[model samples]
Target: WLVKKTPDRYEVKIPARIFHEYVAFMRARINKGMGVAEDAIWSAATECLFLTSSARTKKDIEDNIEREVIGKTIGKFRNKYRSALRYGILDSAPDIDVLLLAKEIDAAVVANDFGIQKWAEELGVRFVPAKTFPLMLKEYLKQRSSISHSTKSDFFDDFEES
Candidate 1:
């Protein structure tokens, strides 16, 4: 598969728990009749690179659940969320993993995760806003185009792509 073989294009990272959560979310979305290209999801997971924060990150995610639901009247989803937040299982994060991925890889994060976007600014990570991607995409594409401008030695530096 392209993802497994070549991670250069779509580098991604996630807390171990959040990774599983993404799987469950994907499952629920499909079950609930949300339409998505399966290949895209699979690529985002299997092909994209992944990472995790400390264990406290998982606890941070669990602690936020009640307040999160209180806002949404998310009645039945509570326990499911805790279980999902259990480390290395679901989309739990002290901060969202997608944002962490953006920070780690310096890649333009393709997500509408406002939570992550908020933290990303604080962390000084650049994010490609999901909803406004088309408007920003010309710049994003321009960045991509310059990828090859870096010679092999320069591309491998520790400073990150940006």
Candidate 2:
């Protein structure tokens, strides 16, 4: 759900759900003409790590149970609670995983889900919209490439001068 660039490579940290939905994630980028983002994700995948937390799983189960029980009983207030409480809330295990991991590693979350975005803001985690992720990656790569090329050219020029 998010990527962090280290000196050597990009580190993509995702939950099991994202890992399972990997194809769909890439397809979405491809559909949006974001081949660069897709490529970036693929390249990061080589160094990616899939992680899960028992605490997150327990919280997910408890939340689900509470929601199910409350959902059935709150006939009159159902609409109100549904709109206010559930509208922009983390509802899945993957959601929790993304937030927790991003917080732990101090990485920006890349997701379009409103729930995830809302929670990221509440948790003070940085967020990158999925739509613009490719653009950002492309710019970064271009800058790095240019810098490398210029450095090489400068080295060669110095050698020739010498």
Candidate 3:
């Protein structure tokens, strides 16, 4: 969270694996007696998820294991979260889609995979670990939700010197 962008408002580049991890983390938090909102979890899904077209298809296959083998509805839960990425940028990859988006938008990549880290370092892309993102994001949203519209200035005014 100490990392800051040159532009104040920016998108984050999320790998599909990290996106799935986020959904599982959110589900675990809710199921483990944490008072997390479903929308908060889904909103995270909507915010930064990204994948190559091939990875997206592969992810669906991974998520279908329970449904296909165990006659369970895990795929339904996964599908709900996956649908949130319909508007996500679908690029081609050697898992370079995250790097490409991060470079394009000067955005940070939310990922923890060693391969992604290696590529990001080689490309000079900024990154944050996936493990900390959920708490950081929840806090950010909490602060944002507390802002009073009447007291707020125009979006660009936020960049002005106080």
Candidate 4:
């Protein structure tokens, strides 16, 4: 319905490592006595995040002053690429491909990672908060429904007043 209804182009991009992290997170919780709601969240994420790798990872970040402050103040982001290397977020870290895709496409990313969002902003990209997505979507649909029903509702209101 979303793809069909939206009049604009929809493109998908992902960090291979982040994608893997989400996938692994979902898989680990499966059949572990998760309740109905948890299962639904897990299922929704698992189903939606499934992707076929179309490109390899690539990034192009230069160390600078703001990056230093941002890294220290907000959250764990400054050394995200480095930490990815140490923690093996992917088989390798610093997947420039993820950030490069954001830069090249000039699109907003949906993510929970402050690192990805901050760097994306620095690179002239946008990021949508992961938790806020459902609320946004719900409000959008609600508005659409209201508009769709308003014509009939207005006619009925006029008749009732008469």
> Pick by lDDT: which candidate is best?
2
Worst 10 contiguous positions by lDDT, candidate 2: 45-54
Q: Which regions in candidate 1 have their CA more than 4 angstroms from the true location?
A: 1-95, 138-162
Error of 4 at 39 (Å): 38
State the weakest 10-residue window (summed lDDT) of model 3.
85-94
Estimated TM-score for each candidate: 0.29, 0.48, 0.34, 0.35
Of the pair 2 and 3, which is ahead by TM-score? 2
Question: In angstroms, how far off is 129's CA in candidate 4?
Answer: 1.5
Candidate 2 deviant stretches above 4 angstroms: 1-86
lDDT of 2 by residue, 1-162 (tens): 798855642355456466436644543543454345444543343222212323443334445544464434444344554455446656555777888799889999999888889989987999999999999999999999999999999999999998
Rank ordering of all candidates by TM-score, starting from the highest: 2, 4, 3, 1
Clashes of each: 10, 0, 0, 4
Q: What tens-digit string does per-residue lDDT give for candidate 3 at 4-91?
A: 6485333555565675455456545544432243445444443323242234543354434423533323345545544453223222
Candidate 4 lDDT over 52-74, as tens digits, reads: 22223212222343246333432
TM-score: model 3 vs. ground truth: 0.34
Model 1, 16-130: lDDT tens digits are 5665467667557643432233334433433222223233433343335434633233333444554454433223344456655776788666556565666567657886667
Cα distance off (Å), candidate 4, residue 103: 3.4
Better model by TM-score: candidate 1 vs candidate 2: 2
Q: Candidate 4: which pairs clash?
A: 57-97, 58-96, 58-97, 59-96
Q: Which regions in candidate 3 have their CA more than 4 angstroms from the true location? A: 1-94, 149-162
Global lDDT scores for all candidate models:
0.52, 0.66, 0.55, 0.54
In TM-score terms, which candidate is top? 2
